[model samples]
Target chain A: MTSSPEIAMPAADPKDPYAMPALMPSSADRAIRSFDYADFDIPTRKQEDFRYTPVERVEEFFQPFASSDDVTATVGMIDGSALPDTVTVRTASKEETGVPAVGEPADRIEAIEWAAAPSELVIDIRADTPTPVLVDVSGHGLDLAALHIVIVARPHVRADVVIEHTGSARLAEGVEVTAMQGSELSVTSVQEWNDDSKHVGGHRLRIGAEATLRHSVVTLGGDVVRLRMDQDFDGPHAKSDMLGIYFVGAGKHYEHRTMVVHNHPECMSRVIYKGALSGEHAHSTWVGNALIEPTAPGTDSYELNRNLVLTKGAIADSEPNLEIENGNIVGAGHASSVGRFDEEQLFYMESRGVPERQARKLVVHGFFKELVDQVGIPQIDDRIMATLDARLDESVAAPIAEKADDGTANNNENYAHNQEEN
Target chain B: MSTLEIKDLRASVETKEGRKQILNGVNLTIESNTTHAIMGPNGSGKSTLAYTLAGHPKYQVDGGEVLLDGQNLLEMTPDERARAGLFLAMQYPVEVPGVSMTNFLRTAVTAVQGKAPSIRTWTKELSEAMERLRMDPKFAQRSVNEGFSGGEKKRAEVLQLELLRPKFAILDETDSGLDVDALRIVSEGVNRAKENTGMGIMMVTHYTRILKYIKPDVVHVFAHGQVVETGGPELADVLEEEGYDKYLPEGTTESALA
Candidate 1:
């Protein structure tokens, strides 16, 4: 095996990627620059990649090249845990750990985020952290915001990091994570924003030989939210798991698009995401794409997406795409489904003396618990579960007819009317 | 003591064919301290009485009134019935994915008892209960009934019945999925609950095999959506010697009674 330095760019695919981002200017690419529209092109639904996305709404919410000067952020240990405090956090410019040394942008929104953030925040972990490091990024009254974060886990070490976005702003950020050889890392991104907030981000995870990475996202807030997760193997025998849980509410949109590129041989990846939607016109979408290159002969990959629609007038879109150039691969498969509450499951719980509202809450919580447990970090897992519980209680913990009584839902009559179908 | 009385109960279930009546003008009563064994062949609507009394939404109450201690049970939700001291050990328990047994048990106990059991006592009780049922300690950590064998699920139902401590429990063919050893272990648990709390039991079974373990105080023979005969425990032996064929009308075939 050649001890080669990391390559930021992947071998361009002829037909697999489907859509590519226009690169930044050579000067801006060399050094992080202020907002620049030259690096991004207007996306239209005519493009297959952009068809499911509400491109026009995203374009109008916040334009590229705008800085978040008024916003503030704070990074600290979670819940005052008595964990090791050796993690080093810093803020710097392009020269820091060779900016853009990680994976490249896979879409136009990512390119815009790269050019908009004023500076980069770099976090270096020399060993496994006893406590999780949290970064709370929030915005005040503002039209747009941008930030950049880089996390590096040294060889044979482990690290856990959580980034929480809150308050109001049209926010865009790019996160770069690199796990060196034999290292393990987990990064959780939670979007708990105000009703007026909107966010877009591209997170790139690169792993060295035999390294492992767990990347999870919990999206529960914001009016319009979209995140792109891109994974690439820098060396052979690397494994990664991408997991997420999202709850979409009324007149809001939350979409997650992912691409896992097996550029090295003997690598494996698994992706599982579950979501629930409530309210009128609330929408959620999951798009998973796994591409296996011909040289990656021992590649094994699978992805699954499932959605539960709680009330009427909600939409859930699930698509799993697999593009493999090598027929010699170990295995490859994908599956997705969007469904309503299971009548049998509900009846089973109700028969046990759990109220209908409480039964729905329990069922929804049960649906997400399997994936939440895989988060691998106890404190973070509990925190996500707490957030999920709060969301469930707020929306699904009551009878639909009661929600209609408050005039919060329009077609809640469908909830009890479906009794005939069940 | 609590008494459960079902009077003139009539119910129908919707199928592809149409809404078919499953329970027709049935009547029965059980004091909290007594046990009743419901013996009926398949399609005799024995299980229907258990589910309808427990408030399954699929079973429309065309006409009926179920009173628990003189309070109308039909007016309450399933959970309310449970809180009011009623439980059902289903023939086939539904598997709830992602919900641990410990969590479900705690929630159910808290809801039924109107308070949470202390952690120390709760842990000790659950562990001891699992041991009595010959279940591995790790089974408590598993998702509720998910991927469990039939015997394991049956044991889980009994486990819940014991912990919840309701006034009455409707065991709908609880013996169907058990081997001899499991049947003995489960029946002993039920007997312990009854002896300790005087929890009335309506044990519904097609065969008299389970009756050998837990003796029934009263036995009722059901046919064609109604009870045709009521007798003491000796009736179980009579039916054991003579199959349900005698209960059918002279001209009618026993195929529907299957």
Candidate 2:
């Protein structure tokens, strides 16, 4: 075990014996939530949630405006089949949607979106699903758009849902999920938007007794994309696995934040997020917050965030915060890392006759293999890998080609020497 | 037959103190099908020579010319050197996470051969090679060298050597951490590769125990970054009995022996 530096504590004041201690609030407790747009102020860098984000790029989504009708969402099966009888998709007013709000909007953008969203798209699953539900969301132009989706998994129902985003738009979106008792539900949200687009999303989940929820987020394209996920346990013996994968290219920013609250006994949660950045001004950030409440016992929770920086001008920030009020709980831990490619690993592969390009690709693929496998959709998995490979090749090949040109010029003298020996 | 020639090779490594020369004007030549043992004490540049031959970025070549069959090996990149029929079985093989042994080996073979091997033949060949080395078949599915035992790592290195079939192979202290049984198993794998491909071998080690199993046709005693003595297999026996003390400079301190 590694030893950590000791933290100095402030001495208690003797003047006021009954004075409450000035303790810093937990991240979850510090977050502000509201359902009304007027209740939220415009976010800035001063806010902890917006500290790492390029707030100016997504400011358009922060204001209350009528959503553009250009945005459209279509629901279909992953295998191109008709919707099964067990599942139904319909639009309803927010007040009459039948599914209670898991949590209020956590930020200005979400609040603005909640107020402007015309209606909620509801997908209700009553039984086991034969195929994954795919929702393709597209924006036609650079206009402001809002989306709200509610996914309900009835008792003992098992289903998979996918939300795919594409096209150019300044968008604000909210996704709410409720896994009823004994149900197993998996949801994946993929953002592959146009390079000129910006997006802000808030995803809220409530897990019921003995229910399981697998939530994944994959962000690949966009000038700026920030997603916030909040998970709360509503009953005992619930399990939540949150996974995220992202790749930020040149002049792009992608940020993901997750908050898991354990309010029931025998609850388990695992958060794993991995990302890679390349090229000038490529940046990515991950912030994971896990809170184990005093009322919760026998809770098993851990969060991990890892980032790989593939170029000189790229940057990655990873932060993991855990707040445990019940020491008697099973366990709670968090770990994070932001680093570049391992030179030794590269050398090992190159020594085995793998070219530098291929070696780097293999290393990156290996780095993300575990988390990508957790996505569990072969088509999406393959798409993510291919996109990663193409981006890596473009970013890695340019510098090597330039270096090779320089090498040829510098080694001209060496070539003459070789000719002499030959 | 192919020949690997090292002429007046001088190299240095950056230490905390500054640039320190490791291989000072070293010279040697080995022909295909020959097994040459390079015996040296710790810090005597045995591993440096191996890594330099394989183009490790840590060791900078100050002045040298390494010719493999009249082609300058020093001018080629590490991967190019491998494709040019050279291999190095590192002492501490790297643990590459998430890259399965099967994937790594297949990619390597494809790069070296300039073509991807047929799936049917490649799978059969890989399993056959693993079986010969007494390696569990599951290792093919596991990440390359990750969570492998010391003995397993060494066997994996030789497994690559047998499969890659390069013109020359450098074993950098391949027997250091192996037991008697593991050493023999690893040695047999090396011998089988030599017999099948007639590939030359440059085995670097500090001890002579491995010589008993994989007999060296020639032995060179290295000290102070240079080859001080060269002889036949009998030289290994002499070093085994006397140790590297006689090879050190006069009055060299014990700490400097390493």
Candidate 3:
């Protein structure tokens, strides 16, 4: 590892067992940011940002290390067509891109990833494309890796981009998106890793004047996945809609944090996230923060988070915070909820001859239909529903499997009978 | 050919106070192609009989049995009972968001029939049923019962009854909130089901106004969780004129009417 003298160092050695604390930030945005590995302290359970995360499971990403070349990335059209002429894709060094970085890292994992990534995979969209651009990243083995991606939408350009993560790896990633003036861009990051994978990612977005951005995060599979998204309106008349969906299974942990900052006047932002948890040890956390500065007058912002707990022993924590320094804003509000399956809905379905398991599936599918429709991509919507169905089946079968072990032959008989009739 | 018998059925519900008994030794029987209207005051357990037969989880069955064509109805789940040719037209249909009315109807039909219906025939049949009920075609695409007016909810219920074609139907206060035109439309749908399927009907209501449209062969006056009197169709007119005053105990207060 190369060490630079210009990097700021902490006052005490973070490795020392008995070192005096240097600094502790009161707010989430006040966390330290640096390029040097030693400047940021190793995250622990005590830190607010890391409290809900399984810090021990992702310790490898917090330390400085060399990233393996096993990770590969490819770009193509969603329809299997060749890349459009209006779009260009190439790998360049961070300095070669010449695009100003949107924001700094907020924590140790992000800082380590920023300093370790060898090059950035940059994709530039000059005009509207016929189909969505697909960036597929796959990890071949269980190895430490780092990825940096920069997406630039030129002035007045319109495009849809999807970043898909699959396979198993302990990786840290940084994705930066810039929507230039008068441009419209939609970016969706889908994390569907293998059962043993661990991932930490940071997404930074900057929206220019008169621009619109629709950002989405869909996390389905992973052992421990944590992502932090920060978006800022750099000019007036910018609008953003941030959406997310996540499903946590047995022994899985998923956390998503979003921070939307309105720094310019007449900017509008909306953030909505929904998640479902099933099976024992399944955990999910969602924290949404919207901040409107005093200078950002006439801003309209709202953030909402909803969670459905499908079974016993699963945990879901939802928190929504809104801060507005300017009372002149059009509206600023926040709402959150964590609840279980509605018994009345289940009963209603059952009364119509739908069995309990199938009834639960229909209700869950309905719960996500609204947000899934907002995704506005048929392929992604179908894929997301298919995965959610499979996971829900597993969740439904788990309790029945236990019931079978307990020798509840009647339930099994009923289930088999229903299956035969179907 | 088919019959539904409720023998000394008793039920109770859990409230803030305690387990309150709602049904006490309620007995009734109806044969195919016959309509029986059960008239009762509020809180007299008329709706309880319908829900208990449908196997709603909130009502606990303390004793007795319900048989549909000689099969024990209480032993089955709600879905199983539905598949066994028993239908309940709820007074207040539930609102299920994001589940389109067409999709819900198709699923229910599939579950009850043990197989899926042909898409071509199903679509035509649904459109025809809605047209007969004076319902807009766009309702098929809307969520089930969501944002529907009272009249619309009742019409949707009757639409299901006609489509499912069950052998026995328990209409729990189906005419409570309908206007004159909506009442006639809904009654026409029920009469069509009877003519097409020969289904037996147990229509529960508080007022006899609906008896004019869906004529009943027998009328049962219910009070204090028990059926006190049974007579012919003319009994409805007697109760409609004099009210349920004679059915109550001597010197019973008006507050007990509900």
Tell me the DockQ of each model, to 2 decimals. Answer: 0.55, 0.69, 0.62
**Deviation from truth (RMSD, Å), model 3:** 9.0
Chain A accuracy of model 3 expressed as TM-score: 0.87
Ranking by lDDT: 2, 3, 1
Given candidate 2, what's the lDDT at residue A409? 15
Where model 3 places Cα greater than 4 Å from the true spot, the runs are A1-33, A36-39, A400-422, B249-258
lDDT of 2 by residue, A62-135 (tens): 77889888689999898889999999999999999987888899888889989988999999999999589999
Residue A213 shift from truth in candidate 1, angstroms: 1.6
CA-based DockQ, model 3? 0.62
For residues A107-198, what per-residue lDDT tens digits would candidate 1 score against the true structure? Answer: 67777777777778888788888678888888796567778899888888877888888888888888999988999888999899898888
List residue ranges in candidate 2 displaced over 4 A: A1-22, A26-29, A400-422, B253-258
Top candidate, metric DockQ: 2
Instruction: Please name the candidate that would achieve the greatest lDDT relative to the true structure.
Output: 2
TM-scores of all predicted structures: 0.87, 0.93, 0.91
What does the lDDT come to for candidate 1?
A: 0.81
For all candidates, what are the clash counts?
2, 1, 1
Per-model chain B TM-scores are 0.96, 0.97, 0.97
Q: How many pairs in model 3 have backbone atoms within 3 A of each other, for residues 3 or more apart or on separate chains, i.e. clashes?
A: 1
